[model samples]
Target chain A: MSFQPVKFYQTGTFTVGNRLLPPEERSVQAQTKRFNSINSGHRACQGCGEALGARYAVDAAMEAANGQLICANATGCLEVFSTPYPETSWQVPWIHSLFGNTAAVATGIAAALKVKQLKGERRDIRVVAQGGDGGTTDIGFGCLSGMFERNDDVLYICYDNGGYMNTGIQRSSATPPAARTATTLAVGDEPGNLFGQGKFVPAIAMAHEIPYVATATVADLRDLEAKVRRAMAIRGARYLHILVPCPLGWGTASHETIRIARLAKETGIFPVFEAEHGELKSVLAIRRPLPVEDYLKPQKRYAHLFAPKARLEVIARLQQLADRNIRRYGLLEGN
Target chain B: MLKQIEGSRAVAEAVALCRPEVICAYPISPQTHIVEALGEFVKDGTLAPCEFINVESEFAAMSVAIGSSAAGARTYTATASQGLLFMAEAVYNASGLGLPIVMTVANRAIGAPINIWNDHSDALSQRDSGWLQIFAETNQEALDLHIQAFRLAEELSLPIMVCMDGFILTHAYERVDMPTQAQVDAYLPKYEPRQVLDPAEPVSIGAMVGPEAFMEVRYLAHAKQMEALKLIPGYAAEFREVFGRDSGGLTHTYKADDAETMVVAMGSLLGTIKDVIDEMRAAGHKIGVLGITLFRPFPIAQVREALHGAQRVVVLEKSLAVGLGGILATNVRMALSALPIDVYTVVAGIGGRPITMRSLHALFREAERDDIDPVTFLDLNHDVVDKQLARERSTRRSGPAAEAILRDIGVVAAKVAQEVR
Candidate 1:
């Protein structure tokens, strides 16, 4: 619900959310009164998408929950950066357990709340489990699946940077094919990551058939914020997997993080869509989508393909993969 | 109500009395019955207003407990052997964050050979993991200790592991004086967590502390466990007042006042040790049995006071440090290092091996004459071991030693490599 239709003066100037919009219409991020859940003065990298995503998601959750949200964070870039011993960046009640137990911890929090609420206590306290790609799609998969299957009252948000970015940018099952990570080096015939290795976990979440599942990216902060708010609005097992770009890990310019993520959604590689009870609700339509090479060419992780050998064949295969996702999800409107 | 029941079922009943808000568990042998009974209780509405989560793994089990405990709910779970190790990281996380979650560790052997029977190796392996560790000597203690465990954990804001002998106490049918919920409620107060995950009074938990605060953070954890030493006996005193029974404490000594030699042990094995000590004392032997109910806090002061005039102390533990000697013996030696007593360690009941009364008789006789080795494996088949040692010395590529020994004894098939085993 944009204020663009009603107010013509603040059109491009009030790009997303601003003072021009009504208080109810403005996002939590738009208002200066928003609780900075993951506050400033943390050691997040320059233009870190996870940092941005966490801020947007947690603030939106806090707003939707009416300031009754606690977080369980997995050990990754977010946990490590936000808390470094004597100082902490977390403004809300937060917990950082082991690398992969965040989902279960969040489930436990929900259980505690349920037990307390059943006894006629306040029932508004909600729980969120947040993790990077490694913690979600790989190590924490079983717990996440269990949480979804149990329909635990939790909103699990996975900030997918496509690899084990926290552990020095290694290959995770979430790492896309033909992506160069430390473990999946660009030194082989099928250079970077081998095709058919990585997993698409949002579909896996849908297979469990929980309440809500959606995908958003850091490029569209408004969309990410909206999905988080919507997920928080639901009662049971909601998953919102946001594709966050890691500037350092992806070998892209710090400012290119949003641009890269935008390209990822536009190219139909990481399908921006929502599903409720395993049925597709809608897709964030891909507008004027370019080829996969247009998305891949910016990062140094894919510099090998551009120089000495313009591996058009590899780019073509990647395009085919994106095309497949587009066809499967009907990502282009009216398709 | 006193009734004969399986130790696991008894423990389940005792836990039910504590009125936990969240109970999560994964199925591991010997531990299965406890959770299964609790599951039935939840289903039947006997344990009402509780969340019984059948978690996927031991890791998730502890993780769930951590969350509930942090959210100020009395939480619980159970595991044995590999399951304990599987949740080892979360185990540390629970205590590190000082969540008052009580867990039952059905003591089972950790394995490469994968033994499922009773042993203290699993519980003892987590000694340094920052949880308060206690052992049970009988089904009654197993039942009573769990009730106290919840209070002790909540009071201290630390996780507690109540280790009971698996299959021995867990599977064995024994009479237990199970406390009523009224008694438990009157004794144990509502869980008021020292720190909780509440939106009204929000505080960051499980923060990533770096070097500056990491050591201090660990020191505080250590300090809390040390505080358990005083609170354990204090709780036991209050428990005796409430229930009219002598159950939990730092240590329990039987006929140890005027004894010259004393046997020190933990868990259900202490019952067997006490029985032999009783027979020996009746026959004019100056020996006694000291059962350690609280092991992780290691009861240094009480241990010293218990063995004050004793000339000799025998430390019998079921778990070994592998390459090093007895696990309990190491701690006992350190606890008694200030004294002039001679401490002997006899590693026993490994992989559920039966430590018979006959072996205890011979060992005590040898201990009486001062003929026992400094470190002895009780009733070990020395012939098979010596042969295996020689076979290993005579060759470079000696096969799997356990299988080799089994083959020699005709237990393993001749072509053991091809056998299913």
Candidate 2:
């Protein structure tokens, strides 16, 4: 609750409307000269949350570094869509390495920047690596953990779209429970994704306790941009796990991508919090939280549950999980 | 200055003189001393202003190198057998991105039975990985090739892997004429990156080239390697002009001018082949040794010119292609295709098995008599191989051949397959 309600406007509203705030207090993206790091003309699907997430993240990083930013992108939707063959959407110095080594590659860039700075070749250049959930949670996990353990000067942003959306919506380790995917069908005894599997990477990232860790979503652009800027302000290893709703993978309407992401946070299923050196600092508390079904009902990944006469027990279990997260992180404390 | 130093120390000194800015390291057996020596240099302020990163895995080591190299720093790393396999994907990406990073691959046997000995299988597996592969025949050459590798890689904008025999060269101490810092500085200029990640004027590196231009992109990589074939010898000559020594070349010949038979090999094993050749020469036999320093970019023209007219060529290597014969033999035959010489493929020194000079002397005599098999597995235990084959043929489920062989040999207290990962 430390973030003040901008008093000039309806401060409690969750929309990023055009408002004339003071220059210092205004968002980085409010600037007409903000680097369109992920520019237009990319082939991302309509309402691609990852595209928005990357734009906000890299732009904020660029602003924080005073336009001295170099990005390493993994081979996922962002890389494939942004730089399709001859055309690239990135307006900054960006490199697309293998899918699973973005964190390590960014570490290398940071190492080089430090060396060059010592040699008086370059100055104040920061690095950022972006990837999908599959690359971040599974394939690139080891390298990410290595970066964290070494306190590599990088801000690794994982755009979690739940599944491997770019590669045909397969079941990644970040896929939610009781959700259908190409690999996790809706036909097993429990159906969809198994209930008791997968990992919460942001929590594990906090366990490393390097410097800074946070979770944001595309639903909250100002918050996402703020978190990115906050992370860029720090010096050591930083992790920002962003929940980006995939309209294609989650089987939701293109217009509902932001709504679904907002519902995800309001349901208390995805906690929005920040940590520094393994200590919980601040949280975006849920105001008038809704049940998990309000979030899950619109997504077609959970369609089988409703069609087969309402899997009430599974929905109840999901609600309990969200409730537990709320209690643990104090999501509804002030509200 | 000729100093009696261990081979690993020699390599470290040479690498330090080159002034690498970022050195990523991970400890795998037998390759530890080289990285450890570099770490000490970074620690004691000898190699100043270097980031000595102790990465978690070989994957991280190469990943860090890919990042640093792309960022326009002189990057270096080292690994061996299993460590090589662990970082295989990043290994390919390093070259595919065209980062001029230098790596030292201490040659070692890859596992199944899990042995950490000298072999070419590890390096040979990465032959098509777009790296300039260079082998060294002696500790002095091992030290010299690393200095040459950095120059060669940076010149071509491709990674160069400098391979020396694991325990044979890495752990062995010998008298090496170590170059002074002044001589090395005179030989190698400050690394000028061909492409870099700069904010002021940025270019997207490692772009995802689709089917429209993937083939052309790959062909250009081949063209760069072809460019290195010319640059390698020129750098060696420059190195000689500056250092006052002869160390690296595509190929080196020892008395092969009028020989009827020439033994061809790479790495420190050429030492043994040359010794055997000298002995045969003194015995009134017209035999010689042809050592291949540049294994990749195969030095086809030089290989053809040196051994084209020889009557018999013995291709001695330490790796096999499982069902097929020696990898080096296949390459040598490909190089000397026009000639109808009897190319005998000797598969030796697998899993760090000893290759004695006495055995080589006898083998060379056998080659002279034309009484050798086309493919010879040197020092193979027929009794053990036969027992394993027999058991597999007798039963549908032969429990595990490596362990069965180990049991049949009555061996205990050996390194298990624990290192397979």
Encode model 1's per-residue lDDT on B253-359: one tens digit a residue.
99997899989999999888888888898899999988999998888888888886899989988988889888888888887877898899999998887877888
Show the lowest summed lDDT stretch of 10 residues, model 1 chain B.
B412-421
Compared to the true structure, candidate 2 yields what TM-score?
0.97
DockQ of all predictions against the true structure, Cα-based: 0.81, 0.81
RMSD of each candidate?
3.4, 3.4
On the 0 to 100 scale, the lDDT of residue B129 in model 2 is: 97
Off by over 4 Å in 1: A1-23, A188-190, B393-398, B410-421
